[model samples]
Target: MATKSLASCIFCKIIKGEIPSFKLIETETSYSFLDIGPVAKGHALVIPKYHAAKLHDLPDEYFADTLSVAKKIAIAQGLENYNILQNNGRIAHQEVDHVHFHVIPKPAASDEEGLVVGWPAKKPEMSELKALHEELLEKLG
Candidate 1:
């Protein structure tokens, strides 16, 4: 069955040509466009044509194209250091209901430019990690 698209989705509208976008590249399964509200120069977005609210909701077939397109955009722009970001839920910073990847270029050493992230690393018990790994492995099987 074909995946149903939300007509109200902004990305869907862009895909349908209803909305204008600064298109960078387009493939059979994905679309790439320059971000209008860029955090840095050469900031772009790559999205799968198949509309899904979250990454887990998307099919495996659509995965390769999205990453490939993102790679092409980064290569074409000569981005040496950059970030490929994807958010799932609203609380995780996903503003759009459609799954998309952000290709943010970190051109300079200034924190003011590009993606700035705070890594709050925590030390957990090795036993906890081992238990979680076993649970995940069993689930995978």
Candidate 2:
């Protein structure tokens, strides 16, 4: 793979041992760490050792490995419920550029600091919905 932008990227520094994170697991393809700013207790972020700013940019191997790490953490963390969130781009509210999956452990009663999932309005105009569906289909196929 080609060299990636890692100069000042936080995750890169974490991978390079330049920073410290609450590391849960590490493997050849991916690294898993507890989120310092977690959505909930045991909330973790899993990412590839290689840099990628968005989900589509991520290598399949790395994505798979990251998910594997997340699953293990979920079970080990004793999560009653969980959500896997991977956002991209500014519009998606992805604060970090690195492609990371948030493994959030949500229970019946969540702490005030934890993530509370929200579903935005799905009431788009028919034309807008159709156009978006077509575009996504093209990309998928």
Candidate 3:
């Protein structure tokens, strides 16, 4: 069954035209719009029309459509470099309950306003890696 909008969701309000947004594109299952709190000039957000709190909670077709719209936004913006970010839960920095992907177009490397990430690399034992990989593969089955 198709999901319905959550009445209290800000994104749902945007989708329903109850709230105004700088809309870029809209498909049967997804909607793309310019972010009011953008990280860069062409920063945009692609969201499924259906209200899904997490990525895994969304229907497969809706999730796929959301990603497809994000790609289209990047190409339309003429972005050579960009970041697609989706936070799943509150612990992962998800402020909004709706499932949305951020399509942030990167500027020059020196520009700090774009997508910035800190990767703290750590090398783990081969056995640890193998165990985790096996666990994930089993879950995927």
Candidate 4:
């Protein structure tokens, strides 16, 4: 498991108030703030107080507060349409090493605003999917 890197982690610095941020909500286990560079006007980020590079690395206890804060931010912003995004690594578009959830509001139906996603979905044989599902179930158990 990854340990907290308080001294070197930027998110940790923000949480400790060593770096200034446009603060939104602060909970016992999470901190939320406005995104410095927003794809949309109400884009915000919620992060767990415990430092973790990925969601799977985070302590289970930290999850509720992180998700709850994101929900609160979305509701407070009155976002009718939005995307709650969490990226696991650099290849997945995670710029910061700390685990975070982005609450990006879709204020308008424009390519210029909000997160624009491309879904290059692929269809696989049902037998292949069944085998994958069985493998995952066994691992989960």
- Tens-place lDDT digits, model 2, residues 1-141: 443657889998897778998888998878889899876778899978888899888767676778888899999988877888889998988988898889988866645645675768677899998999999999999
User: Highest TM-score, which number?
Assistant: 1
User: What count of clashes does model 2 give?
Assistant: 1
Model 1, CA-based lDDT: 0.94
TM-score of every model versus the real structure? 0.96, 0.82, 0.94, 0.95
lDDT (0-100) at residue 134 of candidate 3? 100
What digit string (tens of lDDT, one per residue) describes model 4 on residues 1-141? 233656889999999899999999997788899999999998999999889889999889888888889999989988899999999989899999999999999988988999999999999999999999999999999
Worst 10 residues of 1 by lDDT: 1-10
Off by over 4 Å in 2: 1-5, 109-113, 123-139
- Return the candidate ranking by TM-score, descending: 1, 4, 3, 2
In TM-score terms, candidate 4 sits at: 0.95
Per-candidate Cα lDDT values, in order, are 0.94, 0.83, 0.90, 0.91
What C-alpha root-mean-square deviation, in Å, does candidate 4 show against the real structure?
A: 2.2
The per-residue C-alpha lDDT of model 3 at residue 86 equals 96
lDDT order of candidates, top first: 1, 4, 3, 2
- Tell me the lDDT of model 1 at 87: 99
